[model samples]
Target: MTLSQPTDAMHRKGTIISVCRIGLHDIPEVLSCGLQDFLEKPSHYFFALLIYPVIGLALFLWASQGNAWHLIYPLLAGFALLGPVAALGLYEISRRRELGLEIEWQHWFSALRSPAFPTIGMLALWLLVLFFAWLLTAEWLYLSLFGSSSAPSGPLALLADVIGTGRGWRLLILGHLIGFCFALTALGTTVVAFPLLLDQHVSLRTAVAVSLLATLKNPLPVLGWGVCVALILILGSLPALAGLIVALPVLGHTTWHLYRRLVRIDGSVAIDPKG
Candidate 1:
């Protein structure tokens, strides 16, 4: 992803980002290839999902030991925000796979050591800010809706509050609506931004703009990708979130392949419209 400096780019010192036109069909193709890649080197990708089980296990532990079961819901919903950051490892694995190199434990952990480290760091900070903002918004929503009554004494009380009354119904509906907004914003802005920064020495601004343009150009695939991510997250949330141990790395690798398919050197996908 080394670039020739011609002074036309703004995001990095000498690189241009590409935004390729894609279609709904490209979605499955990219995902299938990515899953194959993950399966090829299951160990590295397993370490990628290792982070999920750790987070899931810790959250489950806290939920079991504390009465704040309600607190876990917001954190779980915000997983999508942290997901891109989490997938940094998988991105590294995917990058290594594409380069025909064997994975090394020492170098694989060095995702932050890219020449584009500053831009990637800035993007990560921005995502973290969005995550905290979502958390605060969820807290404010609960407080505004139920005031002091919103606090649940236990897991059953929390369950009842979420499904037992009109206020409960209101909270559930509104909270999901707000969470969807946050997730959608994140999806649009970061669907390819992180991968682009990982794969190329591009500026944060270029990476983001290219990501947005790619989404806008390929609405159907992006829409499908969003649905896929949400469905996997929901499935992962079941069984104490253990499913994420398998789902996250697969999807993380899928996202890298998606970026590969969605961007081209000249900002156009080499696909036949009628194919």
Candidate 2:
């Protein structure tokens, strides 16, 4: 990730950065609190979900404009890479709640300029690179498997080529396999960066490194939480994409709590934080 700068206050640090011990049970606990947050201000999160329709529309239009309907799969899947950025507001809300602040609606918009916005922005560009890389890789896979010489008339034609035969089956498995690797990297890199940046003044590198370190420190719990997020998002995307209205924010809020649960030390503190 490429961070232009941390906030001015980041230089006058007060917290120390250190890893925390996390257990499997903590997953459910944080999730419960996340759900509670959503339950309390469902409307705030509901508005957050509204962004998905716009994203869906953009994807739909992009796919429609070309013969590359196969590109849509990666585009949709890459949406997860962008998930952390989308939930920035939810992180602010959770931070406000943690500080026992007034929980003003203004926090939602203010989160756009979050204290560590530059760091998070760099982290975002990194994810976007991964996102487009997946798209390009998917395009290569489709072209290689189906041959560049062959041209499909439309989405249905492309669908048949990728699902209608043995070659198609191979493409499906290999494509998913490759895509899973991308998704897993995204999950690890960003699982905690947003909330960490929201809550502390650490630089982009420190925030991302800690996120990866936290996952290593608490592998099973982090992986399980990642799985839960993936499953919820995948299942929720069905049934007219309405489920994201609840699933996204609940996970967003839950993720902030998960960040709190995982990051026991902040580098801004007096005590030196662990690597």
Candidate 3:
């Protein structure tokens, strides 16, 4: 089956209804679908994953320059370059399931035919929010450490200043708080929201609410997943972005699975309208 072709009406509706009814227990089936697709059409997934290293290298090299503004251009460029790849990865997964076919590299471009402008616009908005969150967290950490002191003249000096102070515990607490807040706001919506947006023409409010409800319903799994993601992030930072090549792809794939486990689509079950 190909994405360009439609499944039988009965099968299409039935699959969706079953998925909506069984909910998280349907995760194994969903993952099986994704795995079959991935194994059959490895190229698209591989290529999509490849963009991570390219973007990571670009960011690392740019950051090495220590120029604040220089970082922005590469960041924007990386997003522009990688956003489509990430979207393609996601689209292939959805298209594979929709068509009941093994994933194919050909399907990678199918998402480009989706409502491109709105998708890209939403992605851009997401990036902006992420950037601000990072900026705020960094600023808070710096202030907590330096106590509003003047900027240190050199990287080595700055490191020395930060390390010399007995404020490591304080900085850790501040960083943890920032991370917790960011995680709460971001994770609640992240699991299903993006995939929901891509798979269905749903409003952001509905997607976000569904995502949050999913998290709240299965807090342990969600928290474990969060820990896994945080560990990946910490690893990515340690290698000066080299780790992102692995981390990003894993997170992207895992997140797709997370969405499959969480959101309902067949309308077999009714979400509380008040929620």
Candidate 2 — what's its lDDT? 0.76
lDDT by residue for model 2 (1-275), tens: 11112211112255656667677878888899898887877776566578885777688677878666777767777787788888888887777776666665666766566557787788899999999999899889888888887867787887887778888898899998998899889888888888877676568877778778787777888889978888888887776567777888888899998887776653444311110
Task: Give me the runs in candidate 1 sitting further than 4 Å from their true place.
Answer: 1-16, 60-66, 266-275
TM-score of model 1 (CA atoms): 0.85
Model 1 residue 191 lDDT score: 89
Look at candidate 1 and give me any clashing residue pairs: 11-203
State the local distance difference test value for candidate 3.
0.53
Local distance difference test, each candidate: 0.75, 0.76, 0.53
Q: Each prediction's TM-score against the native? A: 0.85, 0.86, 0.67
Per-residue lDDT of model 3, residues 1-275, tens digit only: 11111121112323341112123334445445555545554555666667666766676566556533313322432232233236445544654555556555655555555554375457547646765656555665666566565555555655565567667456546655765666656666656666665666455565566667666666766666666666655676467556655555545555676565555456433322211
Query: Ten residues in a row with the worst lDDT in model 2?
Result: 1-10
Model 3 lDDT at residue 18: 15
> Which candidate achieves the best TM-score against the true structure?
2
The ten-residue window of minimal lDDT in model 1 covers 1-10
